[model samples]
Target: MTTTAGSRLRALLADGELITAPGVFDGLSAALVARTGFKAGYLTGAGVAVAGYGLPDIGLLTQTEMTERARVVVEALGDVPLIADADTGYGAPMNVVRTLRAYEKAGVAAIQLEDQAFPKKCGHLPDKELISADEFTVKLTAALDARTDPDLLVIARTDARAPLGIDEAIDRANHYAEVGADVIFVEAPENLDEIERIARSVQAPLLINMVQGGLTPDTAPDKLAALGYRIAIHPGALLAPYVLHGLDALGRLGGTMPDVTAGPQGLFELVGLREWSAVGERYRDNTKDGA
Candidate 1:
């Protein structure tokens, strides 16, 4: 049997090199990330809310919406492992069981659950509310127990830095790790000092969120690796540029069409037109032969 993406991610994590995952909201982004030879892709909640649904990342997406999108993105990603965001596990601790199964069934290699209250805002955003650490621990435990595959990572994220303090966020991160979370994420640490402190303080493999124009500084990959960080997810790297360029393209559409280089064929090629055409040809001959 082929090694599952979860198994692959476990191996990658064991290798001790920093795993960098670019955020992918849709199949196109997932395919592009895979094509670019990334180790993994993050199904970013923010990206999905903004790019997929034209909504903000204020916890508006449903479990079904995220899972349905995960299935498409996982298929498009092929062998690449996907680390998906399951905001608050979609509800209470018991709700996490169904959410965990749904995401696992969708073939994501990892599921990230945060400690924010229902209707959670983006980590970088202010006015975020968090459930008690003990409450989140129960949710994390539920997800961990509900996981069918041991290799499927359960990442625990704490959005307490902005609301509580860096010390509280670090404490929550360690507590989650102790409660069977495979990875620990301390979200939106504002400075290099907090970033270093998180790496030093957390007792498990650490994951950091690297958001441009957000609270965290853009730490270099080498520096992060040096700091003993395991995973770095840049959630808006693609979506930000895509949105900006899309706006520019929309503005240009009212005038003469800009010089078109990659027309339909080239764009289709990026999405495996040739491979699909070959499959069509093979089936067409069988259909014509009535076999």
Candidate 2:
């Protein structure tokens, strides 16, 4: 039997190394991450909302929309395991069950669900509300039971640090792990001290979000690994630069955009024109030879 992508991700986690996953919102981003040879890729909900739907990550996108995008990204990523975000599981515990099945079918190696209330905002943003720890635990347990593949990881995130306190966040993270969350993510630790506290307190393998200019002070991956973090997801590493560079190009216009003249053909090559052309040529030659 083929090794499923979820199995691959599980192996990576067990390897005793820090996995760095870059955010990939579109097929092109996924293709680039795969070609660049990353250990894994993250289908960022914020990236999808901003790039795909031209909206913010305030629970505007539905579970099905994210699932459809996840399918396309997984196809583009080929063998790379993708860790996807399914915010708040789209509703209650039963809702989490359906969301889990949908994402698992989309070939996501891992799915992240947070404790934020419905119509959730980005973790970095303020005014975020969360469901009670007990309530979220039920939703998380339901997600775990709903998965068809045992290798498919379920990451439990807590946004309580902002609204309640870091103590609440840590408590909730440990609670989620106790209920069988594969990974614990304490979202938006405000400083190095809070980050260290979370690393010391959380019992399960930990994941840290490295959002640019966000609430969490940016820490190097090596430093994070030293603090006992297992995964560092840079959700804006690509999208932020892409937007800034596009704005610069727009400002330069006909002036200083570095006119490489690499037009449609170059763009197509980035998305695998050569391999597709070879397949077409092989069929054409066989037809000419009357085989």
Local accuracy by lDDT, each model = 0.87, 0.88
**Cα lDDT of model 2 by residue, 1-291, tens digit:** 798889999999999899999999999999999999899999999888877876666677899899999999999999999999999999989989999999999999999999999888788876788899999999999999998999999999999999999988999999999999999999999999999999999999999999887888989888998989999999887887786677588777764443321422232233344555566569869999996
Model 2 TM: 0.86
Measured with C-alpha atoms, the lDDT of residue 8 in candidate 2 is 97
- In terms of lDDT, which candidate is strongest? 2
Looking at model 2, residue 60 earns an lDDT score of 74
TM-scores for every predicted model: 0.86, 0.86
lDDT of 1 by residue, 115-148 (tens): 9998777787667889999999889999999988
> In lDDT terms, how accurate is model 2?
0.88
Error of 1 at 137 (Å): 0.8
Q: Any runs in candidate 2 off by more than 4 Å, and if so which?
A: 254-291
